[model samples]
Structure formats: C-alpha cells, structure tokens
Target: MSRFLPLTIRFADGGSMVVSSIADAKKALNGVWKDKEAPDYLAATRLVDDAVAGTCRPAVAFAAFKKAAAQQGLLKPADPSPALTMLDDLWSRKGKGPPG
Candidate 1:
C-alpha cells in the first residue's frame, strides 16, 4: 500500500493542488512543464525522486529542481510547498540531542 498524505503544492501562477505520492508530485510538476521544456529535465526529476525516496534532503533537492525549472523558463518564482517545508523541518531535527 502507498502512504498518502494531504500535501499541497503551490504553483508559480499563484495556484495550488493537493497530491499524495511522489508519482503524483512528478505528474503535477511535469504537467506544469508540459507547455515548455525544462532545462535538465532528468536532473530535476531525479532530484524530486531522490527527495521522495529519502535518499536526499527534500528541501535541498526541491530547491535545486525549482532552480533548474526556472532557469529553463518552465516555472516562475514561488515558495516551496508546505509538505516540502514540513519534511525539511522534520529532517533537520532528525539528529538533534534527543526526542522531547
């Protein structure tokens, strides 16, 4: 079974959508890039995949992906998704002194 969460992704156009899995996030990001070509598409996808797979920090990976997309003119300036923010926060606290 797939783990589903109420995640919200905000778009560059001031719009947003809710998605569950990494696949859904990829699909949404791809859909946004449909009209335009993203620079280093594979890299962007890989970053997202790695983030979702817990292989890398989500915020860092997502920031890199967004930068690539924007450089390619595929996306505009926007804030990271709420889910990404939360994941990043949690990841940052992973190796803290101890659980409170």
Candidate 2:
C-alpha cells in the first residue's frame, strides 16, 4: 500500500520509531504493543487491518494509529515545518496594521 504521512512514536527507553504505512502500524500494534486490549489500541488495530485488506482508506488507519500512540503516551510531536512556521508567523501578525 501507499505511504501516509509519517508518525513518530517515542519509546519509554528513549528510542523513537516512525510509522508511515498501514503495514507498519499493523506490525507495531500486533508485534510491539504489550497491551492488546486497550480501547484505542483495539480501534487502531481494526482500522489498520481494515486498511490493509482494502476496507478503508490508509489515511483513516494512519490517523487512528497516531491517536492510539498518543493515548498510550508513545506519540512524538512532529517538528514544525519551515514553510508552515513562516505562515504561522504571518498569521500571528495579522490584524496588526501595516509593518512599521
């Protein structure tokens, strides 16, 4: 399957992993995760599996996997993209009249 936007997960032992596809998420959920029955974990498992089997969009599965990682305290916040940061700077200065 095609790749989704990458999601980084931080391990308690200070290692980090990036998951960018439904297959990667499936492997992480089924092989690496210890708690097999958490609600978010189950949901992500189903979504990722479904994505692999062509039952849902890869984006939906990837998003679910990211949410599960966040719920489990394994999600790593992405670094701000330079282009997005510049846009944010411009937006923050909005409604402030012309530049001096």
Clashing residue pairs in candidate 2 are none
Name the lDDT value of residue 72 in candidate 1: 47
The true-versus-predicted C-alpha distance at residue 66 of model 1, in Å, is 0.9
In angstroms, give how far residue 46 of model 2 lies from its true place: 1.3
Cα lDDT listed for each candidate = 0.60, 0.79
TM for every model, in the order presented, reads 0.43, 0.70
Model 1 pairs whose backbones collide: none
Residues 1-100 of candidate 1 have per-residue lDDT tens digits of 5345334555556566665555665665765443345455666678778988889776655566555555645453456788988877887788553245
Per-residue lDDT of 1-100 in model 2, one digit per residue for the tens? 4467777877655676778877778877754554668898899989989999999998898898888888888878889999988877886788453355
Measured with C-alpha atoms, the lDDT of residue 95 in candidate 1 is 59
- The candidate 2 region of ten consecutive residues with least summed lDDT is 91-100
RMSD of each: 10.0, 4.2
Clashes of 1: 0
